[model samples]
Target chain A: MKKNFKLYISLFLTTLKISAFTFGGGFVIVSLMRKEFVQKRKWLTEQEMLNYTALAQSSPGAVAINTSILVGHHIGGFLGSIVTVLAAALPPLVIISIISLFYNLIRENLIVSYILMGMQAGVAAVLCDVIMGLSASVWRESKTFALAVMILTFLSLALLSINIIFVIVACAVAGVIYFGKIGKKGLKNDLS
Target chain B: MIYLELFWAFFQIGLFSIGGGYAALPLIQQQIVNNYGWLTVSEFADLIIIAESTPGPIALNAATFVGTRVAGFAGAVIATIGFIAPSAVIIALLLFLYNRYKNLKYVNDALRGLRPAVVGFIAAAALTILKLTFFSESAATVGLVNIASLIIFTLALIALRKFKIKPIMVLIGSGILGLVIYGGLSLI
Candidate 1:
């Protein structure tokens, strides 16, 4: 019992540190987690971490949160998952809460708006990098089908201005049908 | 009633944000900005800046920020919970099934399909932010272009793609540049 309690506390603290410090996005957090859990603590094997990451990415919600929950579950079961999630979530909650409280004051300031305008451009560039990286990876894996889907989805959303929820659902159904047909054959081809 | 609305809106965001944090941007924009008018387009961009520079998940940060903006501390608590509720339930069930089955062929296949589409979703989001950044107002007209913003965007992109500077650093650099350039202009 004492050992279990210690594990949970360490899990909470490690995740809290990771959540509080890592910047960028979900993938950054995942890599940091790999360093901590697989390399530092030896709590998880490489294969286990990889599997959990893939599952976390595919399942839904914030990948960082999902990955943390899975890691916690592996180490400490349900209670562990809860602890890690709280640890992961608490920083953003507190930080953003403080920011939002001062949001009006910040928004009304001319200098701040100028800074935000500059930051906005930076944000767009970062997002563009993300889009390019994601699309390139998709294009590499599936080629035409993936490219076509990406372009079509972009056009529909950007030009046609369709409701985003509809686009997601349509893609999901399309994915099931398309991938289901390819099935084992596709997997085999990818291995080669 | 407002609390319930916040929960439902964010619950749907949690449930549908399939790819990751970036994937959730469009959904949050649709619900919070477009549907509810909780935030304007420019404010949404600021939220993105804030979410990225700060730690933790972008979706989680956005939920907390938007919630706080709409309803204060309690709303922040509620929205944050609502955003994670689906993730909590879904992940638990997935973990259980994953342990039992040991294979996830169908899930992998669906992800294969969803992955490209998620790229599309994110691209659309980038376009929206880019449009707002570059053009003064309407995208079609391309009315007064913000040359300073364009310069910052180009430099930031080059810095990211070529120099491999961290995004947080790039954001900070851009903000300082903004102060020097824009603040200097205002002085004149």
Candidate 2:
């Protein structure tokens, strides 16, 4: 019982530290987590960490949060998952809160607005790169259906102004039917 | 009433934002910017800047920032919980399923389908921000271009895509560039 308690605390602290320090995004946090759990602590093997990373990427929500949950579950079960998630989420809550309190001051400052305007340009650029990178990977899949879905989705959202939720649901249904028709064999070859 | 709305808005964002953190941007733009009108387009862009620079996932940071702006500390707490609740519950269920069956073919197929759409969502988001940054104000106003912003956009994009510079460094460098160009222009 004592040992279990210690493990939970350590899990919480490790995740909290990672969440607080990492600045890039989900993938950055995932790499740091791989270092901590798979290499440093030896809590998880490389294969297990890889599987969790893949699972987290494919699942949903925040990849960083999802990875933390899976690693927490592995170390401490359900309770462990809860602890790690709280740890993963708490830092942002605190940091953003402090920033928010001074929101007007920052917004109103000429220098700050200028700086943010420049940052906005950079952000737009970064987002463009993200789109290019992601689309290239999807294109590499070489699935006609996938390419069609990507193009149609962009048209619907950008031109037609369709609700994003509807597009997501429609694509999900289309995927299930298409993949289901292909059955187990196609699934293995296509995805794996 | 506002609290309820905030919770509901973020809850929906959390539930539907499949893929990852970037996937949440379109949803946040829809619900928070378009639907609720809590933030203007410029403010939305600023929020993204803040979220990217801060630690933690972009979705969580955006939620906290928006919530605090909308209500107060309590609002921040509610919004953050709403944003994370779906992931916590879904991940817990997924963990159980993984341990029990060890295979999630259906889920995998669903994700496979969702991947292209996610790319689309991200592209749309980039377009929105790009239009605002390059053309100024709305997309319809194409005549009034912010040449400085366009210059920064081109340089930053090249730095990120070709040179493979870190995003944080690019952001910082652009801020300095903006200050020098825009600030100097203001003086003249």
| Candidate topping DockQ | 1
lDDT of 1 at A116: 84
For candidate 1, lDDT tens digit of each residue in B1-188? 88999999999999889989798998898899888999999889989999988998899999999999899988998999999999889887888788899887777777788889888888888988998988853211234888778888999999998998988999999898777767877776
TM-scores of the candidates in the order shown: 0.94, 0.94
Residue A41 of model 1, lDDT score: 99
Query: Whole-model lDDT, candidate 2?
Result: 0.87
lDDT of 2 by residue, A5-103 (tens): 999999999999999999987999999999998899999899999888877876668999889989998889889989998999899999999998998
Model 1 interface RMSD, one decimal: 1.1
lDDT tens per residue, model 1, A1-192: 999999989999999999999887899999999999999999989999999998898787999999999999898988998999999999999999999999899889989987888888899999988888888899998898898889988899888988887888888778778778787677889999
lDDT for every model?
0.88, 0.87
lDDT of 2 at A66: 89
Off by over 4 Å in 1: A184-192, B137-143
